[model samples]
Target: METKELLKKVKEIELKTRGLTKQVFSGEYHSAFKGRGMTFSEVKNYQFGDDVRSIDWNVTARFNEPFVKVFEEERELSVFLVLDISGSNNFGTRLKSKKELMLEVAAVLAFSAVANNDKIGAIFTTDQVEKYIPPKKGRSHALMILRELILFKPKHTRTQLDIGLKFFRNIVKKRSICFVISDFYDENDFYDALKIANRKHDMVALRLYDPAEKELPNLGLIKMFDAEQGVVKWVNTGSKKVRDNYTEQYEESQQKLHDIFRRSGVDYASLSTEGKYLMELNKLFLTRSR
Candidate 1:
């Protein structure tokens, strides 16, 4: 993308996301992810209802009046947007492709994090670590992340969920809210890595999928290609058996993904490319808040 066009896109995304964050998501987001813990913020005159244990004896002695230590939740957070830029993400049968939805989803979360005064970072992967933008707190930094998510070209075309998660675990030592945005299309079972990453970070799975991915229509003869694997095959989609098998396979994968997340004690939700991502995300946020 050209410099001018990229800036325009960044600004456009920023306006929409920032407004939404300020309007709707900020509070939900704040309540959803918790802070590290409470920290002493300041000292104030003691109040009648104040906790007796919170009395600041030194401040009281210095001021010759009762003072109390004030504390607030250390609400700042490091939010990691782990995104998949694999070729398979390019497939969608709706108004927006999986990749497009992924970008928008990342942008919303980025803005929400910024609204809460959190540092946000991004990791773009496609079978390997394509890019890692370290966490930074600022509107400009968030916009830069949105820019990269829009235009980043991956070095590889395959999807390796485990490799990306392992890389994230190694780089981000502190606990963070990690949003793994992918279709969960990897062939390899990444349960071990998922568990390890979850232990280190508050990992959540945002599974993006296209309706077509789950079921095949009765289009007689079709040539299908695996964008990630670079494999091509002809399929008789008109055959009921073939369609049934395809649907079953996709469902099986979905169930397995859900099971893995459940077993690993990770929070996860699914969003279809044809569906409203914001609605699904809002539901997840509310669910987490409760």
Candidate 2:
């Protein structure tokens, strides 16, 4: 993309997303993710009906007046977006590719995080750690992330979900809300990593898919290509048996993903390229809030 065009796109996205965050998602986002815990703010003179346990004896002694310690919920939070940039994400039969949708989703979530006064960061990975943007708060920081998403080119084209999670675990010491955005086509054992991360930090998996992945069209005897493996083959889509077997394989993969998420106790949701992402996200936000 040209510099002028990229700047225009970034400004457009910022205008749209910032408005949504301020007007719509900010409240829901805040309510959905709770703070880690409360922290002491200050001490003030005890007022009527104050809790006895909250009284500061030393402060009271020094001031000769009943003083109590005041605490507030630590509202600040850190959000880590574990993004997948494998070659498979570049294919989509719908309005936008999986990579394109990822940029918008990441933008909205990043804005929502900053609107709640939280730090936002992301890891871009494709079979390896491509880049890691440390957590920071502000619209400028969020714009920088969006720019990277729009223009980043990876050195590799394969995926390693576990590698990204392990890096996230090692770098971020504090508990954070981690959103793993990916097609999740890898065969790696991410269960242990997920369990470890979820035990220490809150983790949510956003599975991105295109409708063509679930159902194949009847383009009889057409050529098919695997984006990741770069393999081409011809299949008779007119044959019912062949179509059925292909569908079964797809469903099996979906079920396996579902099972992994269920057993891991991590919140997971799927977004289809042909459908409304915001509606699905709102449902997930409300579900988490409840």
Candidate 3:
């Protein structure tokens, strides 16, 4: 993208997402995350006065004894956007590409953090740690983050969220609310990494996907390329059986991702490149508020 075009995209995202942050998302964002935030302190044997809702079901099931999750209320907070920049992010059949939607969603969250007077930082990754911007207050810092995001060139084209988590844990010492923005295109076992990160910080997953990812249209025989692997192949999209198989595989992958997050008590939400992100964001905040 040209310099002029990049500036325009940044300005446009600032206008739209920043406006929503102030006009629409500010109230709910505040309500949902007004308090510093919560981080897992530990899980110990359930005591007599422990709240039943705090029971750690998984721990209890594993140990054959009741354990209650303990959380420490944070007094100060930072927001981190751990973004994925794999080659696959360049694919989109919607109004905007997956990369565009990811940036927009990230902008909204960053602006929301700004409005709440919280420090915001970012970690860019594509199978490796690309960059790290330390958390700081001020809209200038936020805008700088947006600017870098627009022009960043990653050295790798694969997705390895585990590396990003390890980098985050190594750098950020305080309890922070982390937003992992990606399509999560990886087979690497990230569960251990995520669980460790969650113990030290509040982790939220923001998944971005494209409509064409789930169901390929019947465009007859067409050439398809593996964005991450750099493999090109021909596919029979016109075959009903092939389409069904594709959809099934996609849905299964989605379900496994959802289950992983939920089992670890991570807040997560998914949005399509062409969907109304504001509505989804509103819903996410509302649910978190409850």
Per-model CA lDDT versus the true structure:
0.89, 0.88, 0.88
What does candidate 3's lDDT look like per residue over 55-172, in tens digits? 9999999999999999987645688999998899999887999998888888999999988888999999988999999999988899899999889988888999999999999999
Task: Estimate TM-scores for all models.
Answer: 0.88, 0.89, 0.85
Task: Supply the global lDDT for candidate 1.
Answer: 0.89
Task: Show model 1 residue runs off by greater than 4 Å.
Answer: 40-72
Can you tell me which runs of candidate 2 are displaced by over 4 Å?
41-71
Deviation in angstroms for 28 in model 2? 0.8
TM-score (C-alpha) between model 3 and the true structure: 0.85
Tens digits of per-residue lDDT, candidate 1, 33-82, equal 98856899999899889999999999899989999999998788999999
The residue-by-residue lDDT of candidate 2 on 118-212, one tens digit each, is 99999998789999999999989999999999999998888878899999999999989999999999877888888888989989999999988
**Native-to-model Cα distance after best TM-score fit, residue 175 in candidate 1, in Å:** 1.3
Scored by lDDT, model 2 comes in at 0.88
Compared with the true structure, model 1 gives a TM-score of: 0.88
lDDT of 2 at 160: 79
* Clash list (residue pairs), candidate 1: none
- Residue runs of model 3 more than 4 Å from their true location after superposition: 35-75
The CA lDDT at 253 in model 3 is 93
